[model samples]
Target: SKLICGSYGTLAVIDEVTIKTLPRPETSLSLLFESDDMASAVALIAGIFASPHEPGAAAILPQPVAAAAGIDLAADFVVVIRLEGIALSVDDRAGHLRGMGGTGGTVETVPQALSETLWRRIRDVDLLADHAGDIWKLSCPPASAPQIIAAIEPHFDMAFYADWAGGLLWLAGPSGADFGTALRAALTLHGGGHAQLMCDRGKSKQLIPALQPLPPAQAGLSKRVKAAFDPLGVLNFGRMHDGI
Candidate 1:
């Protein structure tokens, strides 16, 4: 008679779903800025943080990732910012961002349809299609993100892009890289980065488990909740935990 909606639903019968929606902006647009230097790209993004632009979505993409998305950006890194609202306001903010890239920074805006598609590629790591490796989905502190990427750069050549303002990153580690040691360490350098295996390219056993083991406090709380809701461990087959 009851239903669980998320991953745990596999363990039970589900019937209903709910989706959230946000207010639409009168005019929607995206900005693409490029610089060979990672620091310049990072600095420009930092400047954007103080500017008036309220981006609907914003991300930093490496050259490889940019190419994979068909962005035609030659710079080492590209900073993408999306604005959705009144056309006049959007133009003002877009202009402000373009102006911020005064030296060694080039900026451009793609059509609305193309812009949405590019952002989706970064969001989904679409370019990693057909690749065989683990994809690391990371959530880290916004300003410290650049430092994290900088730290990880020397170890391996990875394709990555970040939804900068959202503090989210999608990175695909190179094959044969140490997922347990190198990947996790890089994700944690800026702060305690919580990672989960969003998708496994190989679909085989991996050094880093799909999900990290829960901490005792969290484990205890979850145990208590599960007991109260589905003590029989019948809701899902170890959907959220080993037992249930």
Candidate 2:
């Protein structure tokens, strides 16, 4: 399961799959907190995660991205925390989050309809869809996000946002910039993480790796596993990595 799940169709052919779906929450609410910058937004998200709220989802959207998602939070950035469950419980949790202070700016509560729209935009990358660039998905420690963003700021004109309480970053960098190298460097300096190229745009795959390179031992294991599953090297050869 581990080998085939993220194999990008390299390991085997999946003819049929089964998935279990959960019933929708009875109600949902999103708490929007205005933040002066990314650091403050991340801090706010961390506080929420530390509390007992058990947020359904959390994200930080820069003003431009928020606007793109039809969210008009007139601030530099907006930290969004969503709560879901029975209507009464959701309302109670939201009130607790509101009283837990240190928000630094205005706070607003969005109803279920708008909350669903906002999360859908975040989940579907609707905020980044109109941008003309290559898309990179970065995963790192939540606390290191601000530093990583700072490190990569000088390399390219980019737009980005954080989800999963700042642990996952979605970035859109100019097509010609060396995104993989720059992002990997930042991740290395701040904290180890992975960056995957989600969209090609105009960049050459030969020039940039679509997936992060594994360590020597892991790389060897990956090759062995690949050979075991597709010995002839015929199934999506080089689809995820070179010479796999």
Candidate 3:
């Protein structure tokens, strides 16, 4: 290749397969918030973010996740929420969520077999390893991801694979997704860090600009000089969503 520039989640996921067993592993717990209306559920969890003394992982689906798995969505919405840590912590959180709505949805520990499947889906990047597309990494407080997911998930038709334990999300949407708007909304609700998008397609270029921590005056001077060099604005304007 003539050039290469991008962020790769895992250059490699596994060298070989191996397994180990624990004599007595700690228990893992999870909850399913079933609702015909997902919008309401989204608000409930968003409320939790307001006070995150102990938040494990929360994901709200505007539509059923079955569509992502190739099955048509049958319900209006379904939210999959998980809380894990020490056994006592997880148990307390689970009890809280259950008390939110009348108990109907199933509550079960993520089975060992299912855990391996989710891990492989997230850890393995072989399928997308070769594509040339800009990869955007959005960073927000861990608790805010669910609300952010809820806000944008309803608008776009795309694929999303989330790694909540690591507070990582990978979303592939249409070419012109409103990343700036989405980021702002998420930041407002959850309150956290900035985001980075690495261009992986169309000549392996860098799309969004790298963030800096310099004083505002120096940053402004640098921006002015760059604009002076290309006063006609010939470069891909606003690709970084910053108005020059």
Candidate 4:
């Protein structure tokens, strides 16, 4: 099940469970970078990417993601990078990433205990609602996350959490989501941003668009797409809008 989140552009890609589980000729390796500042955390990730050897996937966390579950983060910033395929090739690649970090950056295997907990925390947006108010998920490219988050803070006073590089952001609105064009304008001016109307307490039905830029073509396509996936629309019918 491909989770599409855009009307005109690709907002995010949440791979289906089966697609994620498909056997691949690859393996994933996790590298953690510790720092207190977000700049340092991002710097480390960028450095790893700049390396001649680029890994499969990389994640940066200002704090230990494990703490979101229960564990505490001793470091102010913890970045995780994963390399996949051919275990024998991993050593050199891992070494290349570590070398790029200079000193004090600990490159180690992501412990199973912590890895599983963080994975669940990132994928499970439902848990975020418990921490704050009306929750929203924003999916953009990794590099664009920080700037977008800053622009959003002024419009709505809320707590923020991010995943999948900076690409995915989760925030909870202190007030109900009265998201006007102001929110939309900020993102458009500064690159890209999209908001999903998560939970609204006041309305009988959801009041925001699930996907952005609801052009006529996309609006029609979304309906047909939904009908294909869920002919009954039993999932969250009318939650995005009247027609969906």
lDDT string, candidate 2, 36-140, tens digits: 888888888888888987788889998999888777779998889999999889988998898654855678899999999889889988899988988899999
Which digits, one per residue and each the tens of the lDDT, describe model 3 over residues 1-244? 1111121211112346456675543654445555565345556556554555355455544342424433233555544555556677667766776666443644434533453353344445322333334344565655566666677767765444344432555554444335534654565666565554433344222333433122478657645744664466555444333433
Across 1-244, the per-residue lDDT of candidate 1 in tens digits comes to 3435444553455467567898867777888888676656667777777776776777887787777778787888878888878889888888777777757456888867888787677666786664566677777776667777777767775666778663777777754336535656766666766666676666523454556567788878767767767667776757656754
- Candidate with the larger lDDT of 1 and 2: 2
Off by over 4 Å in 2: none
In model 3, the worst 10-residue window by lDDT is 1-10
Give lDDT per model, in order.
Answer: 0.70, 0.87, 0.48, 0.59
lDDT for each residue of candidate 4 in 86-123, tens digit (9 for 90 to 100): 76677678767766665565655664455555555656
User: Candidate 2 clashing pairs?
Assistant: none
Error of 1 at 149 (Å): 2.8
Clashes of 2: 0
RMSD of each: 3.3, 1.5, 10.3, 6.1
How far off is residue 86 in model 4, in Å?
Answer: 4.1
Whole-model alpha-carbon lDDT for candidate 3: 0.48
- Least well predicted 10-residue stretch by lDDT in candidate 4: 5-14
Candidate ordering by lDDT (highest first): 2, 1, 4, 3
**Higher-TM-score candidate among 2 and 3?**
2
Q: Which of the numbered candidates is closest to the native, going by highest TM-score?
A: 2
